[model samples]
Target: MGAHDAGTAGRGRGKRIVVLDYGSGNLRSAERALAHAGADVTVTADLTAAAGADGLVVPGVGAYAACMAGIEASGAGPVIAERVATGRPVLGICVGMQVLFAHGDEHGVVTKGLGLLPGGVTRLPAERLPHMGWNTVTPPAGSVLFAGLPADSRFYFVHSYGVLDRAALAEAGVRVTTAHHGTDFVAAVERGPLSAAQFHPEKSAETGALLLRNWLATVD
Candidate 1:
């Protein structure tokens, strides 16, 4: 039950993509961006709506633990897992991407994550903290997410913690894209049925729009 049917035009013309409202994320911005990218977008917390959508987008902001709590409270974690299990598409943004890992460490505290990816999030080792603002991404070969984009394309980022284990992700057969703050960290990940970005695509302007379009193309 993807968004658009077979007859719809390109982009998300008839597609039904849901922006999960798990009590986190820049919902309106994401919704608007996806709509512009041609999806029939809905921002909701309804489990049925999330599960039934053609494609699901899990967007998040703030702490990893708080986002995970909202996902649990909304009963959306199982829905996301089910979607992944069934080979349906799911995209996570920012902390949405972070929580998909095994766990996240903020300050000295650690919290369990969705454990979808075999990794943990930790503070970026750069000289400066937060790793905010725009940075260029180095997409892997044959990267569907970065397809048609420039090699040095910049994406918006506002993060303090990220997945730093590139080797583990590669060993797990996940396609990765990296960006450097002071050191390298996972900027994006593309595994079967699951794709996530540490940066906010909705806030990334044209480059972000193109990335969303690429992901939307895989919805069917």
Candidate 2:
């Protein structure tokens, strides 16, 4: 039992999706967006609901260490890892996506992440910090998350750090979508039951809605 729970607890309402509430990220916004995408979304720290949901969404904002602290305190990290290992769908947004990596280097400190993915997160080599606002992504061919969306679809982003080691991710056989800031970095990834977005789809307007809908369609 954690602090919040959004959406209904009713049965057969829609696709059961949990927006993990580990004391970070835009829980309500994500809740509303997922529900709009036809999911019976719940924003909760309840490990049971999180582990057993049809789909699990991990949303994070702020710093990498703080988000990881919240997730660890709420005991959601192992559950997310377990779900991913068992072939259940898990989506990470923004810093949430970054924490899926091996570790993150922020402000001269390296913090351990959930380690579900191959690469680590580091500062974007862009001229500007916090690459905010809408930008188009280069989705890999046959991307499930970007499906039914145009190649030029623009998604919202707000962060200074991202996974820039495309070669490492490629070597791990991960399907990556790259978005260019100062350099090409991972935008989204779809491998097995794990998917992540460095951008905030909930705030990405129509294109974001379509992406959320695409994810919901993959839920069982």
Identify the runs in model 1 with alpha carbons over 4 angstroms from their true place. 1-9
Clashes of 2: 0
Write candidate 2's Cα lDDT for 127-157 as tens digits: 9988999999998877888876787899999
Pairs in steric clash, model 1: 2-54, 3-15, 3-16, 4-14, 4-15, 12-38
**Residue 204 shift from truth in candidate 1, angstroms:** 0.8
- In candidate 2, position 168 carries an lDDT of 81
Q: Pick the candidate with the highest TM-score.
A: 1
How would you encode candidate 1's per-residue C-alpha lDDT over 23-137 as one tens digit per residue? 9999999999998888999999989999999999999999998999999888888999999999999999999999999999998899999988989999988888788899999
Pairs of residues at least 3 apart in sequence or in different chains that clash in candidate 2: none
lDDT of each: 0.90, 0.88
Candidate 1: what lDDT? 0.90
